[model samples]
Target: MPAAGSGLYVGLMSGTSLDGIDAVLVDFSSGTPRLAASHHVPFADPVRAEALALCAPGADEIDRAARLSNALAQLYAEAVAATLARAGVPAAEVEAIGCHGQTVRHRPDAGYSVQLVNAALLAELAGVRVVADFRSRDLAAGGQGAPLVPAFHAAVFRDAREHRVVVNLGGIANVTDLPPLGTVRGFDTGPANILLDAWAARHLGEPFDRAGRWAASGSADEPLLCEMLADPYFAARPPKSTGRERFDLAWLERHGVATRRPQDVQATLAELTARTVAEAIARECPGAAAVCVCGGGARNDDLMARLARLAAPVKVTSTAALGVDPEWVEAMAFAWLARQALLGRPGNLPEATGARGPRVLGAIYPA
Candidate 1:
């Protein structure tokens, strides 16, 4: 048998933000996760548009989805090849790849969360083993089947004597509270960058507001912010998760965001993100020693400032301080999950995902 923590795995993640692909070549041989090599592949404008279209009802969705899956697989294979080449590691020398495909539809309450990618196609193209469909087993066992990274967070960022929190500011933000005792807890905090991106795209013609500059240029509309905070999703109890289904453009139009001045709406949207995330941390992990954020949103200086201000005195910083860059944590988590599957170990946290118990996640395809 191959030695544990003596192998390399590549992790692929394209989050709900529909931004791009993040592929990381992670080495576990050192007994601690290290980024050997990494590369990001942005989706073409047309590809990103189609991905957004699939989030809602659209024409030729079935055929488009099937085509998109294959296209994504091809892109995924290229990414794998690029990362391995960058690391100077051949495909045969690598172990397996853990892939978190693009999440267009996540409906845990309905007992299904779809992450679109073809593992067989990827395996065939990359000529390496693949592990995917990580959410299904936990969903089958009666769980939220999300915020899956807490287990990985606990493994890497947890302190034996001190409490810590890891907040992922993805399309939708989620937080993992690692206390010194008891079970680890995590859940979706609500919209983070998705709305910010959507609003930015509409008014600024950009995929996202760079560093949230546009929002920082305008003041948040207080009434609208209050109305948005009143959303039941915010006050809902834990063991929860959400995605494009709950907070998409339709959700925004219904909230009368269109009628408001565009810049103010953008400001309110950014404020909405910061407030929901900060309040969640304050409420869920009051005594957390520090809140380390990781994700695309972490790079937004204005959003980070808001998070720091709202979660003040509790300490807020990026995962960089913890020896990991903010943007790659999710991808790295999937790499660790892939390792767990290959080792026949459990990857989901029961308390975090509301699973029946610890269960080995993901399906594996041999090379």
Candidate 2:
């Protein structure tokens, strides 16, 4: 692998949504990092099913998880090769590949967050150095071990003249507060696409509610929305993170969501995401002038419209306005994290993760 400061790096990310992997080749030769190429590999149905099944404990977990880990590494390797080919960059020139792996479980409160990737296999298959397991070090330092992207957001999105908040709407939603001047802070706001997509797949027979159209077609159940808002996770103070472990289909059912109209439940879910995110911003990021949104939720017109209404007086826009494509920001952040790891730099912001202090994240596997 080449030295850290100036070379190509590939970032691979597969979030809690069970969405496919996203890969991006980033160029850091210039003072500013630039996206050289991007590619996505959707998960095959069986793979997605197995991953979702592993999120919760099941029979034969030990054997199942090991097999799945190897499968994910192969998928990650393919993503790296395709991304490198798209960028026309040779594997040898790349400093390293940062793979966030597939998170089957994230229990930071228990001092661990499991992201399954056979880093050694990925390095051998992709023919490049690999950085994986980025969260373990933070957890070891008494931190939540999540919302690690805030460090990257602060590095790339902070502006001296204005206070900005970057919200990433993946399976779960997280907010990063970038003040014109202050310690950067971030945490999971609540569920984003995870529930919405699952509900859509159940009712609409689709992977997701594209543009949240089905949600727009129905009215939000005020009582249900209020009931969901009362969940302690939404009200919990920062230095926190959550995943499917807390908010999933079972969670919706426990709230008697089945009694409500499917479309109404979908609408309520969308409202839930919008309200939690807007409220988080209102509470933690007061005086912020703009909210830059990224990730799959940014593409949902219904969710965006609801957020825009709730976040009035504050401009709501995609990261594209800030010169980063919303869909690719997380993947790019991992690439940046790999560079940080290679340089022996701390990647987690202590304020964001509530760690003992700064920590150099991820373990490297040689090519």
Candidate 3:
């Protein structure tokens, strides 16, 4: 059990989409963390431009990374304040803040995963101990250092009688399979909104295709989807991880779809995501009772439809049905991770992330 009077904590996360920061206020006590409130703060145009620019492969990457880190830290601090203000909580009442930071590149196989964050600045601005850099230690330990949320998912969403697969379709789609009574397994299935968003922004002049209406309006190009699936990443065994580096715009262009219509490409990308995710689940946990979709992809009706069709025999539903809002699931996972860090608990499951062994994750920066 946690010591008495261990105050509250706030967790901040910015995913691959470069969309915004998600902050959640959590109360940690007696070994469990409960969500108190959550907030989403969209990125300003200049900040977004800077962040996107930093993702390029070129010189001065490290220098640009440093600048972006401090900028993102300020944004995280602001998000924390906003969340606390809306929750009617005082900063002094909080114990710490957990920030996942912005992932510019995640290559655990190379023994490091970079998540740009300024912990010192976050601590100074938030006036609380900040736990950040959660994935490096696991990678250093020869693990994929990803899908870290499965441990938290097992803790919060596991059911005693039914086996469940929790699929988080953020920029990259990942699924965590939790059986009624056994070890859980998880991995990045493939591209999710990243490709679709990029395609939409390029062709439709929008950040994302709302409700996947654009995709639904077009038809999937089966040849393009097949070419995409041929990428060895999908066929490789579990405990793997990927980012925009592998499945971004360049990758789409290389897959023989240059002349295809934008909506058709979106449709094919959405299908690829759904098919890869379902294939992973079918290969890993064929008996999964239902697939619970989460992350931003849950809002895409066309993606959901494709997932439903791909799932076929398996039913599909959102994490909301299991008491977790799809939008806040990742943020909540980080909050739970912070709680685990405080308890000196193992946050990564070896079976899920292919770690050498169970290990406690994250570094703590004092307030």
Candidate 4:
């Protein structure tokens, strides 16, 4: 059944995956949120290439980033239109749109993170108020300005009856531990699909290791996995986060991954993702009752199988089993953030993002 509401909102997300834009129409008139409709608009190859290029040194980056931001807004607008159409809902009914533009680079320690998007352009194109740039304020308040969805996860997925750990496996993997009685704590576990996808693209000419089949074909290089698991970032204390800046293709090559068989490397990368995530849960939320995963990694069977094995004795399932689809949970988070901003509530969890206190996130662009 479709979500029903007196007022609706839309969420647009282009995550670190660089896959595309995911737009969701949400009905929040009810005390709890519900998904109404969704649409995914993929980036054209040129746009995707340019966005990736901007991640590292390149010529004309200032001008190129500007152009890419405009292009992203256009795509976001199209997604919003498609979502509204799918729901048979009109723009006039939507109170606002929350958009988490594609993240090109993240360097929280330096006190800055950039998720490139033109919110004003999106408002103009979609003809609706837009709330975006959701991390800056958290950074200003001394936070990582990332892994912002833990607050949303706690609000929606937490089982008052037991402790729950929500793990999101995007390009980077992050974990949110919601204990039965305490402030939520979440942080990036370590590299997830970012390395696996990059390796697959380089060796197999594919976007990702679909269902981790390529990885399943080979065995993990245990030594390499041990070395990667030993990295300081893996053991980094909470309130920390990382991104393309720290774990990119360059980092992988420097770690001697290029010398191995491509399939073995893929298997090792899969193990690395699972190991780091499982470790983070054990380290941060000991005695966690169940693990609920979201994000692109949830679909990778090979990776999921490994995580289940590593997290034995503790139940593991996707957020879908809890109510929301795994792929769109992060997108829904931004939608919820937009509502928070409109209502003057804090969106960042001080414990999760390591902020001094709760902070209302996002900048609003008027229609």
Candidate achieving the largest TM-score: 2
For model 1, residues 147-198, the per-residue Cα lDDT tens digits are 8999999989998887889999989999999998877999999999999999
Residue pairs whose backbone atoms clash in candidate 4: none
Q: In terms of TM-score, how similar is model 4 to the real structure?
A: 0.97
Residues forming the 10-long window of minimal summed lDDT in candidate 4: 1-10
For model 2, residues 8-78, the per-residue Cα lDDT tens digits are: 88999999988899999999888777999999999999999999999998999989998999999999999
Tell me the lDDT of candidate 2: 0.93
- Backbone clash total for model 1 is 0
Q: Model 4's lDDT to the true fold?
A: 0.89
Q: Give the per-residue lDDT of model 3 (tens digit) for 148-256.
A: 9899888878899888999999988889999998778888988889999999998988889999999999899988888888999999989888897787888988986
Per-residue error at 319 for model 3, in Å?
A: 0.8
lDDT of each: 0.90, 0.93, 0.86, 0.89
Per-model tally of clashing residue pairs: 0, 0, 0, 0
**What lDDT, from 0 to 1, does candidate 1 have?**
0.90
Question: For candidate 4, lDDT tens digit of each residue in 236-294?
Answer: 79988998888989888877987889899999999999988888898889979899999
Off by over 4 Å in 3: 1-7, 30-33
* lDDT ranking, best first: 2, 1, 4, 3
What TM-score should be assigned to candidate 2? 0.99
Candidate 4's C-alpha runs over 4 A off are: 1-5
Give the TM-score of each candidate: 0.97, 0.99, 0.96, 0.97
